[model samples]
Target: MTPQEWVTSGDDQAGDIPSPVGFRILIKPYRLPKFSAGGIALVGESKQYADIAKVAGQVLKMGSECYRGERFSAPWCKIGDYVIFPKHAGQTIEVKRNDGQDPDQYLLVNDDEIRAVVKDPSQIKAYL
Candidate 1:
């Protein structure tokens, strides 16, 4: 999905999301587009791996102690920023929706795990 669509379509209802603790950050990983640039439909395996190997995500929440340590003079990122992280860096969490739609996936990574912030998440090309 495009960055704008990702933000607008997010499940942000109250009491649905978990607040991060310590120096962790809550991130909602970007879902792979259903079709490639050439309009070829992606297979289920490809979509599943997108969730497993998430590289770009929007910062949803921050722990109380994030960026407060000596290592950081200031916060590297904040909520609403799109960030890049290692494919296998964080713990993956899935939240089931009450409407019985597919559960949403999120990544819980340490604040220091963020490598860079992106101006647009859709421009990121993640390889399988």
Candidate 2:
């Protein structure tokens, strides 16, 4: 959908939802968390992996809505969230493949999404 269409569609319930352009924890089924009912990263996610995943940024990119849709590379982002690139850049981008979460092609993310995760952009070998 065109950005204008997306923005105008909100005309009906604009007051009910806040504009999502900044940093905020995403709600389950992910809408930005707001009020007590809406929360960051859904209330159900366990804290168990929070630490291990922290060493590497962990941002959730929306899984493809359809098989033909182009997967967003660093599409929507949260500060510490990992960005996905279509191709790997060796040491510059540490890619650990996770098995398919769904029947679609798999979702692969760069390790850079972790909280406080930062490396010199120059250090990234080269986008491959």
Candidate 3:
């Protein structure tokens, strides 16, 4: 499903997700398309690499201490906002679903690690 669809679907495994703590933010990374524009299916290894390299995701939850210091006059992003961060910057958390589908992946990143907030996550293409 697209990032927008996934966020709005209300099917996210919220019960299984861990809340962020102390300046950390929980983000649900955007899933890469399984097929390429040329109708070629990506190999398993390629897909995995691309998944790890994905830099854009929707903000799920934030720590109590996030964006609370004098380091900024205002918050750079907020919950439900799509954001970009460094590749492989955060701790990856994978949640297995009961339906036997691929597990959902999330990133727990520092609030300072976010680079920018994206208005449209679908427009951000995977580089891999």
Candidate 4:
């Protein structure tokens, strides 16, 4: 499906939701505290990670000027790229999800706030 169709389709299968505009990019942060280095499951440590971890997120959508903007003038990342950002980098917004908890949280960050892109997000170390 086309990007426009994906955005408007209202299907919450973990891919295709909202589209960002201008210099904003939508990122879905990776789940934190799933397990510890010592092989202990951090079942309820999500809150701790959310409070004090620089997050790695998969890029969902890129704004029109993300690659060629008047502000930054060069693109360092693209859609589907994994990115690292500060713990307080972007504005957090929740979107509806298939899971019946609170809406899934997504970060809306400017192109400049993206620190680095990763080939494999799982390889990045998660802090406790």
lDDT of 2: 0.27
Worst ten-residue run, lDDT, model 1?
Answer: 6-15
Taking the tens digit of each residue's C-alpha lDDT, what string does model 3 give over 68-128?
8789789989999999988867999987766667777789999999999888776765464
lDDT of each: 0.83, 0.27, 0.82, 0.70
- Candidate 4: residue 4 lDDT (0-100): 35
**Candidate 4, which segments miss by more than 4 Å at Cα?**
1-16, 33-39, 45-47, 70-73, 125-128
TM-score, model 2 to reference: 0.16
lDDT of 1 by residue, 1-128 (tens): 56878755746542388899999999988877778878988878886776556588899999999999788999999999999998888898888776677777788999999999998877776676
- TM-score per candidate: 0.86, 0.16, 0.82, 0.70
Model 4, 92-112: lDDT tens per residue? Answer: 987766755456668999888
Q: How well is each residue in 38-122 modelled by candidate 2, as lDDT tens digits?
A: 4444334433232113222223232233112255454344533333232321122222224422111122333232223223211
Q: What's the ranking of the predictions by TM-score, best on top?
A: 1, 3, 4, 2
Residue-pair clashes per candidate: 0, 9, 0, 0
> For model 3, how big is the CA root-mean-square deviation?
2.5
lDDT of 1: 0.83
- Scored against the true structure, residue 94 in model 3 reaches a CA lDDT of 86
